[model samples]
Target: MENLNIDLLKKIVSTYSPAGNETRICQLIKKEVEPYADEIYTDALGNLIVRKKGTGKKVLLAGHMDQIALMVTYVDDKGFLRFTNIGGISPAVTYSQRVIFENGTIGVIGCEKIDSLKDLTLDKLFIDIGATSKEEAEERVSIGDVCVYYSEVIVDDRHMIAPALDDRIGCYIMIEILKTMKSSKNDIYFVFTVQEEVGTRGAKTAGYAIEPDVAISFDVTATGDTPKARPMAVQLGHGPAVKVKDNSILCHPKVKNLMIDNAKKHSIPYQLEVLEFGGTDSGAIHLTRSGVPSGVLSIPTRYIHSTCEMVSLSDVKQTINLSIKILEEEI
Candidate 1:
């Protein structure tokens, strides 16, 4: 779409914000949303909450800003850094990949001699920062230092391939919605949450604080489009998906139906998502005090949690349209 901001999407996706370390990206989002929001603030767990004042129902919209990463744990005598995963990092997808730390230090992942691919595991892998000794490696990195995949975003006519698209795409959609919104009757709380890759921790706090009438989370969902991939109903370029159920929470029927009805009423293309093994911020938000109803709008994604996660630009645009429709109406 002509209105899609590719630069903004790249900036948000390239920012280094792994789980529990979201300050850099949080600042970027705050600046972008300040003019559009009536009030904005960060919570105890670093969730960036922007509020658009209204007299109607209080609606909370969440999109996590964190990405999966690796944390340095121990350094070997030969100057290699052994680390553990910060989130759901598969050893198969992570082998021999490049990673960048916060201070701009780049490192390459290597693993010990293994019999076969099946023998590959996180414990056998280490990071090499071109250090010759343990002291040298310590000079560049330290224990508990986090790093994310080092990959540049590639955008074409209809698709985007990049790292951290899992939730950054969701953040991008929310920002665009705020920029384009004219007026609304609901008091909308747009929260760019943190630590979702680990356990949806930020949403737990944000949902409790807002205590909204209904909640909706925006995140990426796995697709079945790839060759020999798992048999999922979602696919790229098919528009956004309204969540029915996932591993963590069954979407509240009212919220699910609202999203579906809005898409139909507006003639916006959408698919019904039943994710077999993942969760979104709504997983935690729905369980807030007194049990608030919550649902999710998922962008169909491929190669999730890898260096080159892919999503359809058209699907993203449609997701934004469907989200705007839901927010503009009574929920």
Candidate 2:
């Protein structure tokens, strides 16, 4: 499958771009996408919009660039940095992991572990930077400094594992599709939006700005295939998951059918995704202006919002191919 540019994908995932602090990653994306896009610019809220113009129709494809992380809330007398969540995060999985601050200082997230399962909570977690006093810890990393689980992309057995795969993989898919398309039928807007982990806030503003006739969101959704979790309609390695419905928006049937039919015609592997909780940028885009025909193209993911999320390389490739085909179709 042409190797799918593993080096570029790894680089994007490894770069730290947590919610509200996406300047560096956005700059990297701007450098990579400038030659291929007809126009590219950043909105006031830091959403990077790359456009490819055509006369057929206006279509918006959005994938959030932000990943779930933590914000430092309090520093204790013992020099432990206490943090509250900046987005939806599982404190259980984040415990005892090395984290990098926005300023590049390093620390370890430590939570009080106990034999009883009920004792595990976010309130019990704190970061230790080896400082004996709060003054020392504050000097290294401030009270407002943001932190994300420090992990790098590792490719093994045709799968990529790392933090922030939930949407960074989506970002990679959008950029690759923008790079490889031979011809375009629609005026495509490829947006790498911000603050999705917090509340899909960036998308609401950006969607309003574009007011696209059609919209599609590329992001990762949790797989039910994992052990003892909530039942989900997606599974890892199955293929790209087309959204039927999620917590926020019910996908437009015509758009969903178009995606499914395109996948079938091209013989691309795909599955239906019914997310029991959470949402994608499609949620915000669907309600834009008078309303737009919108749906989602999702990659099945495991350990979402944790330090080590996983996705199949094959699934991501399929997502890119399918998106390109859909954009090229006469609609």
**lDDT by residue for model 2 over 42-104, one digit each (tens)?**
999999999999897889999989888888999999999889898887767888888998778
Per-residue lDDT tens digits of candidate 1, residues 216-293?
999999998889998989989988999999999999999999999999999999999999998999999999999989
Best of the candidates, TM-score: 1
Alpha-carbon TM-score of each model against the true structure: 0.99, 0.97
lDDT per model vs. reference: 0.94, 0.89
Clashes of 1: 0
Error of 2 at 226 (Å): 2.7
- Reference-based lDDT, residue 89, model 1: 98
Q: What is the lDDT of candidate 1?
A: 0.94
The deviation in Å at residue 108 for candidate 1 is: 0.4
